[model samples]
Target: MSGQGTEPEAMKIVLVGHMGAGKTTAVKALGGVDVDELIESREQRTVAEIFAADGEGAFRDLEERVTLELLADPSVQAVALGGGALASRRTRAALTAARVVWLDVDADEAWRRVARSPTRPLARDERRFRALHAERQEQYAQAADAIVPASHVRRLAAPIAALEGMPAGAKLIWAVTASADYPAYIGAGLITDRRFWPATIAGRRVLVSDRNAASHYGALFEPVLTAVRIAPGEQSKTLTQAEVIWREMARTGVTRTDVTVALGGGVVGDLAGFCAATYQRGMPVVQVPTTLVAQVDSAYGGKTGVDIPEGKNYVGSFHQPAAVIADTTTLGTLPPAELAAGYAEVVKTGLIAGGWLWRRIAAGAAPDDPDVIAGCALTKLRIVAQDELDTGVRQLLNVGHTVAHAVETVTGYARYRHGEAVALGLLAELRLAGADALRQQVLELLEQAGLPVTLAADVDVEQVLLATTRDKKRVGEGPVPFALCIEPGRALTGQPVAPAELRAAIMELVG
Candidate 1:
C-alpha cells in the first residue's frame, strides 16, 4: 500500500515458502537489512543470559520482538521470513499489509539447498529435513498472495520487475516442475522455453495440431517437428483423429523411442496423447496446450483419450506425457467467449482447493493473473502428483464435471463448449444441493465471468439422465460418485441423490 502510484517507491516484500528457497538471496538483491547484524549487536548477551531475564517463554518473546523491530524501519522494506513464520497464524496475520511472495522451489532443489546449508536450524539431517520441508510447503503455499519461482531468479528479474508494478492486491503465479520427475510444465510461454523441451525429440518428434489451435501459434512449434494438422473442436476429438495421427506416426517411421508432440488445446492433447500412448505399445508424448482450459486442467494429467459415441474419454489410456508447454502469449489471441468459458475450470478448481485461492477466484480474479492461474494449476498438480491413478483423494478434481459432462453428452457437445457446460452444471447442482454461501459465490463468479448459469432449452432431460447413467465415476452397482460442490475447497460424493431429484434439477436449468 505504501508504494501506491510511485514507480520506484519502496514496497514491503516478504519472502515465504519451504526452507532453503533462496529467500535470503532475493532479499539481498533488493538491498534488504541484515538480520544477523541486529543479532550481532547483542553478541555479548549469551543464550543463557537472554533466557535468564525471561526464561524460554521470554526468549520466544524476544524473537518476535527482534523480528518486529527489524520490520519497523521504513527503509527496511524487504523482509525474508523464516520458512516457518507462516506456520504461526499470528505472524501471517500481522504481515497482511505487506506484499507476500511465496518463493516457489521444487522439492528436490529445496532438499539439496537445505542439505548444503549449515545455517538451517530444522534441517539438521536429510530424513528430518525432508519431513519438515514437505510439511511447511503446503502452509507457505496457503499464506502467500503471489508466487515467484526461485529456480530462475536472475533470468526472471525482468518479469519480476514487470510484476512488481501490479496493483496492490494483484496476484502473480509461476508453474515449475523438476526435471523428469513428472510432466509439470503446463503454463503460458513454457512451450517456447528451451529448458522444457529436451534435445532428444528434435529429429524423432512429430507434432499434431487441431484446426482452431493450429490456425494460430502453430508456427511456434514448427521448430519442434513435422506438423500434422487435424480439424478442431470436440467433434475432432474422436477415435478417427487418433487413427489419423497414428497413421502419420507410422508413415514417418516413428518408433517406440520416438515422441509425438501435441500442439493445440485439450482436444489435440487428448488425441495426440492417445496416439503416443498406443503407438509401438507406448511412446513419449509432449503436450503444448494453447488454451487456458487445457493448460490449467487437462494437459498435465496422463489421462489421454478420444470420445466414443458411447461416453466421453471412453477410449483413452493413462499415458503420461513427457512434458506440457503452455504459452500465455497464445491466450492473447483467444476470443472473449473462449476466455470466459475457460474460467469455469478456474472456478471448479477453487471449489475443490479452498482457502485464499477460493477467495480470490470467488472475488472474480482473472485467469491471466499469475496468482490466479498458478494457484489453480498448483492445486491440480498436487492432487494428481499424489494420486496419478485417481484411486483415492484425486476424485475431488471432478467437482461439477459429472452434471457438466452429462450436459455436454446430451447436447451433442456443440450447444456449449466443455467449460461453459460445466459452469452451468455447477450452478444448478450447487443451487439445489450445496451450501448457500458457496452456491451464491459460484453463481456470482459465473455471472461476472460472463458464462451461462442455465442449460439450453433444446437439451432433453431424459437424454441427460441416460448420459449420467454411464459416467466413468459410477461405483459398485449404485449412483455414480458425483463431486458435489458444497463448501469452498470441499466436495461431497457417494451421496445418493434420487433420479427424480436430478431430473428436476436439470429441468429447472433447462431454458
Candidate 2:
C-alpha cells in the first residue's frame, strides 16, 4: 500500500494564473496528456462571445458550472483554469483536492502577451485588464500548491511526469529560490541509487552522523573523507560537538570545494550544516535526513544552528543545501516513540497548511505516508524560498516553536522530545489566539497521533517566561513575536501578548 491505500488517485494538474501566463502552453508541453481548456469546451459560443451576447455575470455563472462539472470527473488529468475562474468560492473550494500550479509572470510580460488578443474579454480594457490581473495574482497565490515562474516552464515537466506515473518507491518535488534551486527526492531506497546522487559530491565528502545512525547506514557513502560521529541526543547540538566535527574536517583536509553530507536526524543536519556554512567561508552540503522530523521539517530549509543554554537554535545561519535526499525506507528502523514524536511536527505542519494536507491528516492518515511527507516538505520549501532569513512571511513557520523551544530549554532538552514540546506549544499558542474551533480540532488530531497536549506537572511558568526573553525572535525588549493561528491555513505573526495572558495560558495547559 502506498500510504493512501491501493493505487494513488490520478492527480489533476490544474494550472492557474493570469491571462497569457502560459498555462495552456505548459499543459501542452507535458506531451501525451489530455488538456481541458475551459474556453474550448463551451459548445454554443466562446467565452468572449458569451460575454458579448449576455454579460460578465452570466459568463461567470456558465463558467462556474462547466468548471465544476469538469473537475468532478475522476479521470480528468490536466486542466488550465481561466484567469478569473478561481475567483468563484465554489471553484476555489473544489480545487483543494487537485494539484494547483501557479504560472507566475511579471505585469509587463503578462500584459504584452494578451494586449492584441480580442478574444480575451478582460483584456479589451487596458486599465481593467491590469486591475484584474493584479487582483487574480493574490487569489492564484493563495490557491496554488506550487508557484513556477513563466521562465521555468520547461522544468515543470519533470515534476508533472513524476505525478503522472509515480513509481512505487519514488517521489519528487522541486525547491526554487532566487539564489538557490534543488530537487528533493523522497523514496523507499533512494540512497542506494547512484543515478539520484550528484556526481559533484562523489569525492572528498565529510559524512556527519551520530553513532547510532552510523551503525546502521554509515557505509552507504562511496568516497568519504571521514565519518564524524557525535553522541546521540539533543545535548550533542552544542558548540563543543561542532568543534569536534570542525577539527575532524580540518584533520581530514576537507576544503571548500568538497561537500558535507548530514546523515542523521535534525541534530546532525543542523550541526553539520552550520559547519558547512562556516567552514572555508561556506561549502556545499547535501542533506540525507534519516528521521521523520528531519525529513519533514528541519532538513530542507537553509536554517542551520546549535543550541545554547540561553535558548534553542540561538546561533544559526541561513545556508541552503545543494540537494536533499529523503529516504522513507530508513524510517522503519525508528522506535515507536521516536516515530510518534515526529508525527507531532507533521500535525503542526498540517495545521499551518490546512488544505488537502490537513484534510488527509484529520481523516486519520498515517504519518509515514510518502504523499504526506512530500506535501509537508514542499510546504516548508515554498516558505523558505520566499523568506530565507526569517524576516517577513517565514515567521509563520514558527507557529508552535516559541513556547516549544522554551519547553525544551527549561526541561534541559531531556524530558520531552522536540515535537512533543511543539505539540504543547501549539495548544497554548492556539489558546492565546482564541481559535477555539481550530484549537479543538488540532487537539483531537494530536491526541489521535499519540502526542502530548499539556505540559508536565513540574514545569515552572516563570522559568519558561524567562527563557522566552532569551528567544532569538525577541527584539529590543519587546514581547517575543508569537505566531498565532487565527484559523486553519491562516496565521498571524508578531503579535504582542501581555505576560499575564502568557502565564495564564501556560498555567491552564499544566492544570
Candidate 3:
C-alpha cells in the first residue's frame, strides 16, 4: 500500500502481456492519463490500416521508437509494452529496474479487445491469431516478475495498493471470494507474504507437488514449508500416492491446524486434497492450482479425491482449502496442448451457468481475454456455490464431462489432455438432433478455438463405451445419463438413451 495517493513518479513500473491484454489501458489508468492525450500520432488510422499500407516492419519500427522514447524519459510515469516489444533484447533489458506486472488475459477476450481496434498491427488480417496468441503466452511470462490478474484490473486500487513500496517483484494480495471464497496473492515474492502461508501450519508446513511443478515453484514453497516432490500425470492420482502423502504428513506429525499445500495441477490438487481430507478426518489444505484446468475447475471446489484404477475420482472427500492461489504466471509455462485442454472446462462453464458467456466462447473467444475468463469463472463460481454438494443444479456443469471422463479413462489418460477430450465430448453430446444447429455452431467455435471436434485417430470407440458403462453416474439399468445441450444456455441432465445410441454417438465422433 506504499505507492498510492502520491503523484506519479519515474518509470519504475512496467505493464506487460500479449497484444490487446489491456496493458495499454492499465498503464493509462496508472499514469492518471487518458489514452487520447497520450497518442498524438500520425492520423488515428487502425493498426490494420498502417500494416496494410506501410507493412509490419514499418509498424514495428514505429512501435519500437515509441517504446524506446517512452522508456528513456525519466519523467515517464509508467510504461505499457506492446506484446512484441518485450521480445526485443534491448527493450527487455531496459525493464530490469522496473517492477514488471503482467496483465493476464485469455485468448478469446484478447481477440475481442483487439478485434474492435483497427489500429492493431498484429491483428492485421491474421486468421491464425488464436494459434499465434497461444504461441506467445510463454514469452510474456519470461518478462514478468509478478502477474496481475486482468479480472482485478477494474478493482485496481486494492491490488496496486498491495504493491506499494515493495521490491520490483514483491507479491501483491489478490483474493477472489465471490462464490467459493478463496484467498490468492501472487507475485514472485508472495512466497514470503504472511498471507501466503497460513499461521495454521505453525512448526512446519508440508507441501506436495509433482516433479514438473516442483522444478518451477518448489523454491517458492521450500523456504516457508517442507515440500515433497511427487511424479506428474493422472496416474499419480491414486490411493498409493495418497498413502505416501499421508505417511509424510504422519512422519511430520502434522496437526489438524497444520496445512497441506497441493502445489501442482488438478492431479496434485485432487491427490493432495484427498490426503489432507482423510488425514485426521480433515486437515486444512491450501490449493495452489498450477494448471489452467485446476484454476478454472478443480482447484476452487472443496471436492477433492483420488481416482482408483477402476474409475476416475472414485475415493475422495470434501476438503476445502484455507486458500486457493491461482497464479496466472504458472499457466504461461503450460504447453500448447495443455492450454487447449484447459479451455474445455472454460467451455463447460459457459455451457451450464454461463448464459451469454457460452456465446462468447462459441464464437471462438480468446483465452487471453479477461472478460472471457471472468464471465466463465463468475458463472462457474455461481453454480459451484449453489451446488457445493453437487446433488442437483450443479450437475449441469458436467455437460461434456460425462463422455469426457470416459474418453480419458478409455484412452488411458495419456492419449488426450482432459480439455481436448472434453472438446470432442462436447461435440458428441451436442449431437442429439434437437440441438443440431447449436451443435454445428459449437463445432465451428471449437475449430476456431484451435480444438478438436472429433475424437483422436487413435482412440478406441469401444473402449470409451465400456468406460462410459462403468461411470458411477449411471442411473438404473439403462444407458448413463449425459448432460446434453438443448441450446447455448440450456443443458439437460439425466437424458437416458439406449446403449446403441451412446455407441452411435461415439461412432459418429470416430467417423
Candidate 4:
C-alpha cells in the first residue's frame, strides 16, 4: 500500500519465469536491466558458453552470486533473473527485497518461442523442455507478486510498476483476453489501499451491489454516482432485475463513459456485469467480488449474464471487466454454509489444475487462503486467455458446470446454492466418465469441505436428466457434450454420453 494511489519511486522490480516466458524481453520493454546480459557482460562469455564450460552446477554458483548482487543494488530499478534462478534457494530467498512479477506462458507457447534457439541450452528437446516448464510453475506461482502473460509484457509497463505496492504474499493476476486486459488482485487489506480500486477519471462510478455486500463493505468505496442495490440470490438474477438497475442508472444521469463497480458474489457480479455490457451499448465495469465463488471463479472471466427459465447463465455476453479486486478479508464475515458452498469451486479448480493448487487443497487449504485464491484465479485466467471465446480448451473449465446448471434449472434455482449443485454435478459427471476411483477421491474432498455430496431423494431425477438436453452448449440436439473427467489435471470436452449412462449417473446422486 506504499503511497496509496501515487506512483511510488521506481525502485527494484524483479522479473522471474521459465525460459521463453519473455523475462529478458519484458525487462527491455519495461526499461529494466537484464541480469543474464550482465552475466555475459561480466564473464565475457555467452550463457551457453558458461553452461558448456562451467556446467550447470558451476553456472548456478555464478548465477547466485551475480543475481543476488543485482537484486541488492539500489540503483537498478528492475532486473530480469536468469530463467532457472528460482531453482536457487538463496536466489529465491533474496526475492523478498523487491517486487516480483512472473511472466506466465504455457509449455506449448514457451517451446514455440525457444525451439531451435542456439542460446538456450536447456531447450534442447521438446519433452525435456515441457517437463522443465511444468516443474517451474508451482515455484513461479508461489513466488510472484503478480502474474501477467508474456504476450502482454511489451505494453504492461504500467501494471509492472503497480506490483511494487502489493502487500507481502498478495498476488495479482494481470488478466488478459483477446479483447481486453485488466488486473485482478487477490489479497488482504487491498480495500484500504486506494491503488487497487480503479479510478473513474472524468466519469463517476455507478456501484451495483446486493444488500448483503452493500451492508458489509459498501461504504468502503463511497463517493459513487449511485448505489444500485439488488436483492441477493440466483432468483434475483433476471432481465427484470437488470432493467431495474438500468432505469436507476438512467435516472441518475449515468453515461457510457462512467464505470460500473460490481460489489458482491457471483449473482451480483454476473447480473451487474450483464448490465454493464448492455447499458449504453457496453460500459466498463470493475468487479469487486465479496464472495469466494466470485473471487475464485466467476470474477476473472468476461462471461456475464443472468439465468433464464430454461437454464442457469443462459443469457450472457463476453463483456470483460476493466479490473477485478478480490479482498480475501471479506470471507471472515461469510456464513459457514456460504463459505462451504464456495469450496466446491476450489475443488473443481484444483482437480482441473492438479498441481500446486490441488496439492494445497488436498492438504486442506482454507477457502480464504490468499495464495490458493490467487493460484485458482491465475489458473482460470490462463485458461480463459487461451480461449476467450469458449471454443475449445476453455470448455474444460465447464467440467462439472453442465450438470450443475441442470440441477439448478430443474429445481428452479431456489433449492441448492450454485456450488452445492456443482458439488453434486461433479460427482455425477465423474460417475458418467466411469472414473470410479477418481470420483471417490473427489467425494472425499467434498466431504472435507462439508459440501453436499448427494441430491435430496425428493428431487425428480428424470427432470434433471431432461434439463441437460437444454444446456447452452447443445447446438443441434444430437446429444449434449459432457466435459468428462477421467483423471486429475485434464478433462475431455465434446464427449457424447449415452442416455442410459447419464440417467444412471443422476440416479447415483439421488439419495
TM-score of each: 0.69, 0.74, 0.62, 0.94
Off by over 4 Å in 4: 1-9, 161-165, 192-195, 199-202
Model 3 residue 259 distance off true place after TM-score fit, in angstroms:
1.5
Q: For candidate 1, lDDT tens digit of each residue in 314-353?
A: 8888877775555665777777888888889988888887
Question: Using lDDT as the measure, what is the rank order of every candidate, best first?
Answer: 4, 2, 1, 3
lDDT, each prediction: 0.69, 0.77, 0.68, 0.84
Evaluate model 2: give its TM-score. 0.74
Stretches > 4 Å off in candidate 1? 1-81, 84-180, 186-203
Task: Point to the candidate with the largest lDDT.
Answer: 4
Q: Where does model 2 exceed 4 Å of error?
A: 1-21, 24-151, 154-169, 192-195, 198-204
Model 1 residue pairs with clashes: 172-370, 172-371, 173-370, 173-371, 187-326, 188-326, 188-327, 188-328, 189-327, 189-328
lDDT of 4 by residue, 1-511 (tens): 1222433345467888888988888888767788889889999998889999989899889989999998888877789988788988888888776677888888888999999688888988889898888788888888887788888768667576456455555677888889988888888877844435643223688999999999988888778999988987877899999999999999999999998999999999999999999999999898999889998999988999998876567898999998898999888888888898889998888878877788888888898898888888988988899899999889988888889989988887788998999999999999988889989988998988888898988888889999887788988857899888877777799998998998889898875
Residue-by-residue lDDT tens digits, candidate 2, 1-511: 1222224345567777888888878777654132234444544566677788889898788778877876677766767777888879998878766677777765678889998586788887778887787566547655665556666666786445434333334555567766777657676676743324643334478999988878877888756888898898888999999899888999888989889989989999999999999988899889988889999998887889898887678898888888788888788887777888888889878777767677778888888887788768867876777777778888988898898988888988889898898889888888889887878888888888788987888888889988866777888878798988787677888988788888887888797
